[model samples]
Target: MFSTSNTLLYADKLTDFNMPMPHIYACHLSDQLIQFTGPDKKSYLHGQITQDVNLLTNDALLWAGQCDAKGKLWSILRLFNFQDDYFAITSKDEIENALAEFKKYAVFAKVDIEQNKNHQLVGLFGDDLSAVLSELEIILPTENNSTIDFKFGKAIKLDNNRLILCIDKKAQLPSCITLLESEQKWQSLSILAGEPKLNNQAIAEYVPQMVNLQAIGGISFKKGCYKGQETVARMKFLGKNKRAMYILEANTNKPFEATEVEQQLGENWRRAGKLIQTSFDIDTNRAYALAIMPNDLALDTLLRTKQENPISIEIKPLPYSLIEE
Candidate 1:
């Protein structure tokens, strides 16, 4: 278990981030784990989510979303299977709300839903992830989203370069693994990776496509009869979606919270989109934000903040292409 003293020690190490490669950090502060177990678990989830739940394997994790009848996202999460049950990792603030939403539909199903606080979510990043895990005698799934049982925990490969380690809260971390102090670094990394997550304020404000969920493998158009399936399917087939997620960077003295994104229309600034998530590197004075904006908007469209002191936005390339597949 990571104790109070351990946390302090980890915080101290964060001061000198120039440490050697193969970094590991506690990510539980920003994320929470929700578990679903029952005979009807798969079928129940398959009917309520946008991803094809039936395709989820014990070895892989799935990115999915739960949306309302109109297809607005309620929560976007990482789903995986462990110990004969299904577990989802989502923003901590949305855990209870998501649980409540899950229960509303799970009432008739045999599934049991509950928060699992016993596990701590940790992020492992660096080129030496495989080597470091090998040193700890941990074997992880090689394929992206795949998972494997490790010592008293589970290891999931979010991608080739990043892994999410879910360890028992009581388990002591290996000496080589260094815990990150601030979540800003992790958040920054996620933005660079173009992974869009939802917070309390942004819930029910975006459809999956608006956030580019389909481009990120979070949506499955072929899946049958999930909540909001009809609307989502129509958008997919009709290609009428006018908004999409984009990465924007700005020079700011401090981090910017989620807010409205505006485009300059001649002499006037008009509402063009909404900022979904952001991370600011204090040292660099650069703010990175993910916003949903008009897809057809010209690349030269001048975008700025809608607040009193507006910041200019510069478009940045996402790791993946936004073109619909």
Candidate 2:
């Protein structure tokens, strides 16, 4: 739970942003792009992350997960190529852990990996996004998992209403765009879109499928071996997975945090499972979350926070389906 103490200001700025039309909105993402340079960048990353590095190109972005040997994730990432360097955008807090895992085996590979402080990630959404980009003489990557380079940044289209922009920290944002101070709106969109927002709290907490990464095309089942590939493969082919990430939201008067959700079992509540990520909206006095629970959890079932004063949240339909293509 976080607050910027600008409820009125948020409403004023985003009034049109929330309209049915696609009015543009921007916010700085609490994420960074790690640059992997050197001759073996592609081949090295190919064996390190879940997605096929060969499939990533200047024209496309790919969702990927870097996992530990047991198939537990270090961080889920969006990988792309911008110029000569291959970049992976992930939560800032997990960078060190992810780096430690990546470097252990890289001693024998030809890639040099480090955070690129020169750029910062940003999120864009709302009114006529493509038209707004065109006004600034920039091309929007219209397809999901697609990429395009513009004068100000490398844009990755997450969907019609959302995108992740990697922009130079020193560059001037076009005057046409308004940058919001708080990231709540941006984060809420990602939560609703079913994109798991991992922090240090989430490290090694789940395998990719537990967070619905495979459902989103983040896993490459047909690709050759990578770190943790054995367990990931076994879970899929052997039907060993019984849990998955799901969307949840509820109105709240004050900020609250919880690790688990409780389900009503007759006269009392029983601990269900853990909460992976959460975002609090001060404006609406509501909380949005991504929780990991048994995949068979009934859609009609409601869950309450595992706290003295519990807030109940019902399941929301994900924009995409859980079944993979």
Which candidate gets the maximum TM-score versus the true structure? 2
TM match of model 1 to true structure: 0.90
Stretches of candidate 2 off by over 4 Å are 1-23
Tens-place lDDT per residue, model 2, 214-282, is 888899998888989999998899999998999988878765578789888788889888887788777
Instruction: Name the top lDDT candidate.
Output: 2
lDDT of each: 0.78, 0.80
Model 1 lDDT per residue over 1-325, tens place: 5532234323432322234543444444568899999999999988888999977888878889889889888888889888888999998766777888889978898998899877878777654665568765777655776888777678888776677888887776665555556677667768777888876678988888888888878898777888888888888899878888888888888777538888988899889988888888766577888888888877777988788778888877777877876
lDDT value, residue 55 of candidate 2: 85
Worst 10 residues of 2 by lDDT: 1-10
Q: How many residue pairs clash in each candidate?
A: 4, 5
TM-score of each: 0.90, 0.92
